[model samples]
Each structure stands twice: as C-alpha cells, then as structure tokens.
Target: MDTVAANGTGGDVTAKIAGVQALLRGLTILDVLADSPDGLASLADIAARTGLSPSTAHRLLSTLVERGYAGREPGSKGYVIGHRVVHFSTSVRRRTSDLRRLVRSHLEAITAETGETSNLVVLDGKNVVYIDQVEGTHALRMVPGIGSIFPAYTSASAKAILAYQVDDAQLDAVFTAEPRIKLAAHTLADRRDFVAALTAVVKHGYAVEESELAEGVSCIAAPIRGRNGVALGAISVPGPTQRVLEPAPERLGVLLKKHALHVSQALGFRQLSCAAG
Candidate 1:
C-alpha cells in the first residue's frame, strides 16, 4: 500500500492527474471557441487550434456540449459558445446590483421631485439596458421595465453615457453595427444628426428625448461618471410627454444633472469644482 501511494501505480493519483489534464484541455477548447470571430468553430478547426488529437477534441467537445458550455450553430454543425457562456458574460449583472444599491436613493429622489418614473441604465454592447427603476406616484407614468433594452442612439439614458465617451471609434462602431432607423417622428436617424445631438448633450450637461423612442413619452437624463470621468451609466426620468416636457425641459434637465453628479461623485468621480480645492 505504501509503495502504491509512492506514485508507482496508484489509482487515485492517476485519476487526479487525468482529471486535471482533462480540465485544462476542456478550458483550452473553450478559449478557442470564444476567440472565433463569429463565435463558432468546426471540430477540425478546434482540434487544430488546440493541438489535440481529433478523438480527444471530439470527446471533450461532446462533453462541453452536453454540459451547456458549447452548442452547435443552427445549420452549421459548428460548435459555438453556449447560452451558459453568454449568461456568464453578463457578470455585469453582479456589478449592476452593487450600482443599484448605491443609486437607489437617487432614483427615488428623482421620482419624488419630478413625479416621473426614474430609471438606472447601463450601456451593454450597442444598447442601453434598464437595470433599476423607481415608479412615480402619479397614476399616469411610463416605466421602461427592468431588463428592457433599447438602441443606444434612441435612448436618452444611453445618450447621456455616449455623450461623455472619449472614444470616437466606439461611437462609430455603434453606427456601423446597426443601421439607423426612425423609431419615431423625432428620432435622429442620420449619423451626422446623431453625433450633433450627442455634442449638444455634452454642451448642455444632460440629454433629452421627446417622443423619439415612443410616441407620447419624453425623457431627461444625465451621465454618472466614473473615476476617469467616463460615464459608467445614466440616471433618467421618463414620463408622459405632457408631464416630462411641460413646465420646462431645462427644469428636469437641471434636477437630473444635480443628482447624477452626486451619484458620480459617490462613485469616485471628482468634479473640477471638488478637485480644484
């Protein structure tokens, strides 16, 4: 027994080494699949990329597919990253939870003051996704449901973040990836017009939308900046166009900016005024 444990021929030791090697090979396959431009790879391509035998690659890939880490692309027979991996990519969900905790009071205050539904949103890919909301007290209001997604260009919340982005390439990418569409009569469908709108957002220190996303609805939003001064997300108040655009758009814009700046400061973005002293 002692000699068996010393590494000559121990079943448990051999099993442990084999398990680790299999785990490593499986991870290598996953990396190759993820690195594909379209997130797909044929079995032959995966085997060649991983430098594994065809039989070994097939076995590992079969296990991966069975376990949901990979799946076959429809009609392609090529392995693609699975829904499980896509779900894992949303680890931002965890970060958003922390963000909601940090910003919930701000959302509530916006709702209380504006009598409009307030939302916390973050840019995901080329879209803005609502993660949290505080409903208005009024019977008539608009609340883009949590987990709702909207084109970045068509959303005031997304424009708030895009207006502060220092990377022009990112803005260009959004246009290149998705064709501009007229979601409503006032939608900024042309790239040049969209860019100008974002520029105005920066100049005005906030963003607004009047029936651009949905008819009879309007929104005002301000960016929440990170330590580097890039927007991490936005705080927005959206409501019936009559209420949101009535009284004064600037009034809502100013209120949103004040609270958004506070949230940005809480998140470690030091304003020039605060940094100067």
Candidate 2:
C-alpha cells in the first residue's frame, strides 16, 4: 500500500473504480424505471428491480432528482423519468435516422387507413421540405416525391408545423422572404390571411387545404410536437380534392391528429399539464 501511494496512482484508480460502479448502479436504476409499465416506480420497486438496498436506492434517487434525471410523481410516492431525459432523447432522435424509422410506421398506417399519400415534412426557413413518403394504394393518388419543397404558408403540413412552432418574429421573417405565392383560387392571399389560417390550426389542432398548393389536391395535417409542446415537424395525408374534401376536411384532420400524437409520444413528448408519472 505504501508503494502504491508512492506511485501516486493508488487513490486515483480507487476513485475511478468507485465512480464506474456508481455509474453502473445509477444506469440500472434508470433502466428499471424506464421499463415500468406506466413509467412510474416507487422507491421499493426501484430498489427491488435494481437489486439495491432501499437506502442505497433512495440516496441515488435523491441525487438523480437533483440533477433533473428523475422526478417525483405529484401526489404519490412514485418516480418518473425527468424532462431532461426526454429533452435529450428528442434532441438525438431529431438528428438521427431513428426518427425517420419511427415515423415511417405511422406514415404507413395513415396511408393504409386513409388511402391517401402520407408525407413527413420538416420546416426549412420559409419552406417545408418533404423528407419521406408512403404512397397511397390508389393508382390515381397524389405522391409528392421525397425532397419536394413548398412554401410553408401554402401547404397544410407546413402550416400545421408552423402554427405550433413559430412565433411572431418567425412569421415576420417568413413573410419577408416570400410575401405571397398564390397557387390556386383558394390559396391564402396575404400575410393577414395566412396568420389567421395558422391561428385556426392552433385552435383545431390540425390544418387543411383544398387546392391551395396544387390544383385538385387536398391535404390535412397535424404537428408532430416535442417535449416542450413545440412542433418538430408535421405528418400529412394528401390526395385528390374529390376524395379528401368530399367528406369534410375535419374528418381527416381528426385522424391525422391522432396518429401525429402517437408519433410525438414515441419521440418522448409529454404535455406539461400531464402528471409526471
């Protein structure tokens, strides 16, 4: 031991080992909590699941909570994954292939259910670019191939995303770039009309357009939200006006909103009003 100290690495090695052990134990606790059926676990549940003594679990949990990696369930003795964890997850998913794969399933589901083209779009300044698509089964279906770009204010998908994601300053910037680009008779004419349309999207939780972007095309879309309730992008179903608009647009809007919420949740988004657990 004296020789080990003389080498000046005895305490350093011991501390590193201790730190590694603590990290493993902490990660174990997180895994236990994550695998909980409803994302809620009590102290005893965590201890038993992690194979740690209750005292040890409690001490670790206290530290985790302080660091915002864990949170207490309001009105109960349960624990939940904290917003910080979700934020980290969202950030990673946004930039990786994981988000596209995760969203692909929902897009396929929407196309199957609606018999219309489903698209995944992300905002790029004043434009919304199509990143992925699940073509409709119908031979005459509308398919905006991947990488298609459109003015944000004219497309249902773009409006749905911008409504939840943009602020007044952002809107001003958008208008400054493209004041108006009328594509059809029903296209919104100016900034005031576009802003009003966006406001309606916020109230309805979706957006719809009838031949606003292309002749005889219609679309309904919902924002894919993040943990902070801001839009990450949008999911949309686009098809012929005859099929999409013959039945009120609200009907399709409801379906789009439902699947969009599922995708958002899969991305670890949770409404602030919801209980932590």
Candidate 3:
C-alpha cells in the first residue's frame, strides 16, 4: 500500500508499468523456449515468435538464464529450460495428491453431465487406486468407499490405461504383479484373448467393463495422456448395466472421452499433431 501510495503519481505509475512489461517479456521468452522442438530456441527464433526486438529478447533471455528458468545449450547457442524448471516439474508430478487436486473439478463436471458416478483412477503398483470420485444424481449408484483398490484387468479405468501397453513384456509383468482369479463370464478367457481385447480398446479409443468387477455394474473409461503422450491415468463413468446398455453405451463413451481429454489437458497433456507430407 505504501509503495502504491508513493507510486500513485503518473510518472511513478509509468515506471511501474514498464517494469511489469519487462517481466512479461522475460516470461514470454521462457514460454517459447519450453515449447520449441527439442526444447531449444535461438535468439532470432525467440524474437520472431515473441515479436520483441533483438536487443530486448537478448536482455530478457539473459535474465532468465541467470535466474535458472532457462539455460544455454552446452555445444550450441540455443536456449533451453534450466535445471530449476525441470526440478519443479518433476517434483509436482511426483505427488499423487497434486494430480488428484487438479482432476477433482473435472470429476465433478463429469458427474454433473452424466448423472452417474465419476472417478479418477491412477495405476499404483499393480492395482488401480481411486483417488477421487463425484457422486451422481441417481438414487442408486456405485458408491464404493473412496481409496478402494481394484485389479487393473477387472475395471474399465485400469483397462483403458493398460490398453496402451507397448509390449508383451510389460503386459506380462502387470499380469504377474496382480493375481487374476478367473471370474467365469467377466474375466478374459486367456492371455491371448486379453492381449487381443486390449488392442481393441486402443483402436476403439475407450474401454468398457460390463459386470466385470461387480454384477449389474458397468463402466466406460478412457486413458488420460500427458504432454509427453504418456498415459498418466484414466477416468471412468460407472452405472447400472441395464441403463448403460440402453440408449447406446457408445454415446456415454464419447462424452467420457471428451472429459478425459479435458483432464489430460489440465495436466499439461498435449496431443501430437501430424504434419502434412
């Protein structure tokens, strides 16, 4: 308040405004460098992208590099995000609670839209952990006590993420990690069928669990990917099987994918764009 009071005059205000402008310019340079290919940017490229003069861009880039938000490439003259920035990024991502907080609002929105139970599930070790959920409007709903753990193969939420398994080795590891007791009609008949089913989930863009975990309960889920295109987690909407089947489960699948993408984007997930040949 004292600073503002002293700076209330026109000249002082102008000086303060100029200082703010300089700070914004420095941050803009960092943004450009962070998004560039290989996370490196040249001064000319930064100036072109930010529309700042060569001198102004260089001064701000220097400030950022000195402050550890950015750095110079070892061999080349290009700029990249500094160690401090990478440290903060990894620290935030390592906290499961931070991710839950970021996704809670989206879970609420999903429940509001679909009027069914909405959940955010993360793959913890071999089991899927329910970190967050929103109660739906329906009187009868799947209200599992929060923090419940379910096998990855039995629930749609985990299946959606496991569907993107890159190789048989990883799939086999997950299977070995989690014991699978054959549940006659619900469980996949064999490893071959399970692998084939997961491939179908990836191709279908979503996963469906029809009375797999609990009788009369069904769910549709989609994998949420991070900016690096890694599967971070999955979101799901589960309700009674009869209602899920009627009026087309595919419609719910579409809506689930839309919300899942929103959550993924909130987590700094970006879809890869294919360039025209």
Candidate 4:
C-alpha cells in the first residue's frame, strides 16, 4: 500500500512538470503568432519557429484559441492574437488598485505643500480619468472630483502625460474627431497650435491650462513616468485662474515637476527626465 502511494506521488510530480513544459511551449507559439507581420501566423510557420511537431503545434494552438488567448482566421486557418490577449495588453486595470495605494501618499503631500487641489490622473483612450483628488482649503477651489473624465487635449494633467507619448497617428485621430474645436476659452487656435503646445510641454517638463477647460479654473501639471519613459500619469494643482498663474504658473509648475520626478523615480524611472529625451 505504501509503495503504491509513493508511486502515485511521483506520477503527480511528473505530470506537473509536463504541464509546465507544455505551457512554455504554448507561450512560445503565441509569441511567434504575436510577432508575425499582420499579427497572424500559419500553423506551419508557428511549428517551424517553435520547433514543435505539426500535430503538437495544432494541439497547443487549439487550446490557446479555446482559452481566448489566440484565434484562427476562418478563411486562412492562420492563428492570430486573440481579443483577450489584445485587451489585456493595453490595460493596467488589474494593477490600478495596488498603484492607487502606492500613489495616494504622494497626492496628499502635493496638496499639503501647495495648499490647492491636487489630482492624480491617467490617460484613458482619448480622455483622461481623474483617479484621485485632494481638495484645497479655499471655499472657491476648483475640484474635478475623483472618477471624473475630461478631454485629454484640454486638460493640463493629460497634456503633460501625452507630451511624452510617441504616437502621432493616435493623437491626430483623437484631435480630428467631432467638431474638433474644444472649449471656447481654449487658447490653442488650431491643430498646428495644439501640436506646438505639446512640443513646448516636452521641452519644459510641465504643462499648464489657463481658463481653458472651464470658465475660471486653471492648473499646472507634470508627468509621472515609468522606467521606459512612458508617462504613467500626472500630478496637477488646480485653483482659480488668476491665482494659478498670477505670479506666473512657473513656480507651481516647478514644484509639480519636482514631485513628479520623485514619484516617477519611486516607480523605477531611473533615466533622465522624459522632457530631455
């Protein structure tokens, strides 16, 4: 009886090892499919690239398709990256909960230091979402509140993050949609002006909006970046227009930039400022 039990345990161990090896092989095939031009690859191509037998490759691809991490083209019988894979590739939704906790202290500190409303905002599609906010002491303070989303083109926080992004085509598509014109008080007169503003923001390490998104509100923001220089989010201080820039927004801009740098460094951005690049 003890010998039979020992044999069972060994069989379980062997099965686990085989399962892990199979998973690795499956991922290798998926990687080949993902890297293919047009993002689709024939079974023969995947089998050749992964050095797996044709039947083995087919089995693995079929399993991946069943799991929604891969798909097969009906006409061509080629494997492509599945919707589930693509969906997760671009979203950090699962990480946001943990990230928010890590960033909240920085937000509170920024508000305390500036004596004004501070926000932590991230780019979501063509808009920016305010994930968190710290209200100012003043009765007339400008507050967008948490979970509010605003146009990426007109928001200082959004612009600060967008200025570091390297996708011109996506940016252009968002700007050209709808009536194109945003707020009536927006200072950017045309697409050309908007492009120039982003360029300046990249050069200056911060962005500012003055009576643009709203009637009397203004804000200054700086980008928080990842180790790869991708803008993760932005930190901004908002207040009444005159006070935001009365002495010029430069002072607050500088402070925001410093805090942004600190938070970004904490997130593993060891390189020089994204503005420098």
Candidate 5:
C-alpha cells in the first residue's frame, strides 16, 4: 500500500477529489449530449444516464457552461455541447491520415494481385465515400474514384467496416435514414437481412458482393482495424463476377483476409490470439 500524508489542510484533498469527480461527470454529460439527435440534454436525463444525482449533475453542467464546453438551450433550458467540443473533434480528424495516406498501398496491391479496380472507402453520414482508388489494366472496368459517394448498405467495403465499427443503434439509424433504394436486384433491403449478412462477414473475416453495386461487377472486402479494434476503413478488390466466383470463393476470401491483416498491422493493430479453453 502507498500513502502520503497531506502537508496542508484536509480541504485540499477534498477539493481535489471533488474536482476529479466533477470532471468525470462533465465528460459523461458531454457523451450523452453528443449521442442525442438534438445534441441537448436535460439535467434529469443527464443524471439518469450518468448515475449522478440531480444536484451533482447541475453542478457539473454549470462548471462545463462556465468553461464554455456547454451552452443552455433557450426554450427547453437543456444543455447542449458547445463549440469547444467541435473544435477538439475537428483537430483530431485533421491530425489523422486523410484516406490517401492511409490505404493507398493496399489499394495498389489489391489491383496488382487481382487485376481489378481497388477502392478505399470510409463512412460519411449514411454513405461511404470513395477516398482513394487504383485502376486495373483491363480494357473495360468499373472506375470509382476519389470523391465518389455510394450508399453504405450496398457496398462491400462499407459493410465490412461497419460490421466491426458501428453499434446496433447507429446501424439502425443508418438504415432508417437511407432505406435500400435498389442499386441492384440483389441489394439487401431489410435490417434482419443486413445483420445476417454482416454476421457472416464477421465470422468468415471478409465480405463478398455479387452484382450488388453494378450489373456484372463483384467485390471482395476486408476491414482495416486500428489499435483499439475499431475499423478505420475497408480494402476491396472489384472485378467481373465471373473472375471472383470462378473456382472457389473461400480461396479468394483467404487472399482478401491476408492482405487486410497485413494492412491492419501497418495501421497499428495488435492481434490478440485467445487461448483454448
């Protein structure tokens, strides 16, 4: 055990404890507010969500308001996250490698191996943005390039990333906001079907699409995860459906998973192998 006697009055220790508790409570309130659709929360709602008393929640919220991290709503008198949180989030996004710097090599390698177009996609508000791409040498090919946005539910790369990264509520929200509009005849239309497809992808460690995005194109996708086990994006190889489904889907799946793991390692994922029980 380690113990240090207070050099000054006990008030200092109590103040420090109170400050730490307030900080934790304030952060919890921020999280609740961020997750809400309106970005505002009442004190009772914050207290219920944070397991804090009403007075404690009020004090924590007041401190946050004083610090300019939260502001009071006019009509409801609820607290909403302020400008500081947005600034901090924007700074973090700016610091991270923006699409091209992160997945270019993986795209190139997939193109080289499969002689097909490769794409790197990230989630953007119910859609997937094609941030980077490498074209194949085929005479006729599908060419999705940077700045192209596609529905997330219909894209293999987007589904692969979403399966590992997003929660159930977020996934529900995505489907609710963007219902399946039939990009192709085989596109998943319902939540149950989509969930089943994602579950299969997670179990097999990769995803495959056959004529979902286009008439004759097929794609194989695998997730690229970071250190925290959250998927940053997905690496995909797209070609004519005949080539991908020719002999064995399992073999193609293996190749996709292997390359995905290599890219994930490059992106700082530390694989954890579980022991047999």
Candidate 6:
C-alpha cells in the first residue's frame, strides 16, 4: 500500500513538471516574437532568441500556432504574435476587482464637481475598457456605458493612461499593428500626429479629446497610477463638445488631474507629477 502511494505521488510530480515545461516554452515563443521589429520572426530568429534547438523551436511554434497563441506571417513563412494574447489579456483586465473598487469614488466626485458624466477605464491590451461610471445631474448628458471598449488612441482616458504607462517602442508597435480609425472629424489619422498628441499629453499631466470619440462629445482625462508608479487606469469627465471647448479646457484639465491624483494616492502611488516636456 505504501509503495502504491509513493508511485501515485511520483506520477503527480511528473505531471506538474511537464505542465511547467510547456508553460515556459510557450512564454519563450511569445518573448521571441515580441522582440521582432515587424512582429515577425523566422524559425532561426526564434531559435536564437529562445536558445532552443531548431527542432525544439519548431515543435513549440507549431503548438503555439495551433492553439492561437502565435501566428504564421503570410508569404514570409515567419512567426508573429497572435490575437489569443490580446483575448487573454482582456480577460485578466476584466477580472481586476481591486482597481474597479479603488476608482469608484474618484468617478463619483468628478461627476459631482463638473455636472458631467465620469468613467473609469483600464487598459486591456491595446485598448481601454470602461469598468465603472457615474452619470451627471443634468438630464441630457454624454453616456458611455460600463463595459464599453474604445481604441486607446482616440479616447482621452486611454491616451492619458497609455502616455504614462507604455514605452515608445510599445506605442509604436501598437500603432503599427492597429492603425487608428477616425471616429470623428477631429480624430488623429496620421501616426506622427498621434505621437505628437501623446507627447503633449505627457507634458500637460492630462489629456482632452474634442469630439474624438463621438460627434458632440468630449472628455478630459488623467491617469491613475499604482503603488509602483505604473499607470493602472484613467479617470475621465465627459460632456458635450460645446461645453468642453468653451475657452476653458485648461480648467477642466486641472480638475481632472487633481481628482486623478487623489485616486492614485489612495491606491498608494507616490510618483505623481506632470511629465516633462
């Protein structure tokens, strides 16, 4: 009986070891693809980056491609990052209960102070997902329902968070992978213009979007940082474009920044300062 029990334990340990090995191999494939310039890496490139033999790399790549965690570039016969990564990231963001709870009061206060709708959004891969919201006192107010997802480039909240959190290389990869699609006349269409806007946001401590998300709607947003001084999400106050454009964008920007800082402090973030120009 003791011998049978020992055999069972050994079998369990062997299974666990195999699972960890597979996970490590999968992560190696992703790291190799992520470092590639055009998001494509040849089998040789992947093998070199992962320090695995050609046959081993091929086997892992084939498994990743089959499971949708990697993809093969058409006509190039190279490997690249895949949509499954984004899907998995989104699922993780959606499951963050602490972030939603932490920013709830900030959203409410912004709505109370500005008489405008407020939203809290978190980065989900290259996009932003609204997780919480507070409606304004006014009967007619801009509304972005909770759970709505928007492009990180076009939304003020998204840009505010992205500008602070993502490195230039990651930002470049984002734009290259999913080019901005204009939702309104004021939306940025060119890559250089978009980069310029992000630079401006970094300098100003907050970002303002004038009818970039929807016609007749605008938003002022500031980033919420975590204890590690990394941006975790954003807080935004949104209203009609006419009201936001009324020669007082700076005032709105200031209010948003203050509220965002309050939330960031509550979340234990210490590096609260305007980005240098």
lDDT of each: 0.80, 0.78, 0.72, 0.75, 0.71, 0.74
Give the lDDT of residue 249 in candidate 1.
83
lDDT of 1 at 151: 66
Q: What is the lDDT of candidate 6?
A: 0.74
Predicted model with the maximum lDDT:
1
Q: Model 2 residue 257 lDDT?
A: 87
User: Model 1 over residues 1-277: C-alpha lDDT tens digits?
Assistant: 5889777679888898999999999987876675453457899988887889999999999999999988989898799877676565466667678778888999988888767889998987666777888988889878656755566767888778888776876577567643455767788767787888887788878998988877787889999888778888999888888888788888899989899888888888887843210
Cα-based lDDT at residue 94, candidate 2: 62
lDDT of 2 by residue, 1-277 (tens): 6988999899899999999988888877766665453568899988987778999999999989999989999999999878776665555446746668878988989888878889888876666667778999898987757655566767888778778753566566567652354768788758888878887888888988888877888888888887767788889888888888776887788888888888889878875553321
Question: What is the Cα-based TM-score of model 6?
Answer: 0.62
Q: Spell out the clash pairs found in candidate 1.
A: none
What CA RMSD would you report for each candidate?
Answer: 10.7, 19.3, 20.1, 14.8, 11.5, 11.0
Q: Give the alpha carbon lDDT tens digit for every residue of 1-277 in model 4.
A: 6775667987787888999999999877765664453557898988887889999999999899999989988889788878776556335445576556767787888778777888888876655667777888877887756655565666788678877775665466546543333454774536677777777777778998887676677889999888778788888887888878879878888888888888888888875444443
lDDT of 3 at 158: 70
Query: Which regions of candidate 2 fall more than 4 Å away from where they truly are?
Result: 1-96, 272-277
Which 10 consecutive residues of model 1 have the lowest summed lDDT? 268-277
Model 5 residue pairs with clashes: none
How would you encode candidate 6's per-residue C-alpha lDDT over 1-277 as one tens digit per residue? Answer: 6875667987787888999997897786785575443458899978877778999899989999998989998888898877787586557556877877877877777777778888888765555667778988887787756655566666787678767753665466456643345768787656677777877787888888887767888888888877666677888877887776567788778888888878778888776353332
- Cα error, residue 125 of model 1, in Å, equals 1.6
Per-residue lDDT of 231 in model 6: 76
lDDT of 3 at 256: 79
Backbone clashes, each candidate: 0, 0, 1, 0, 0, 0
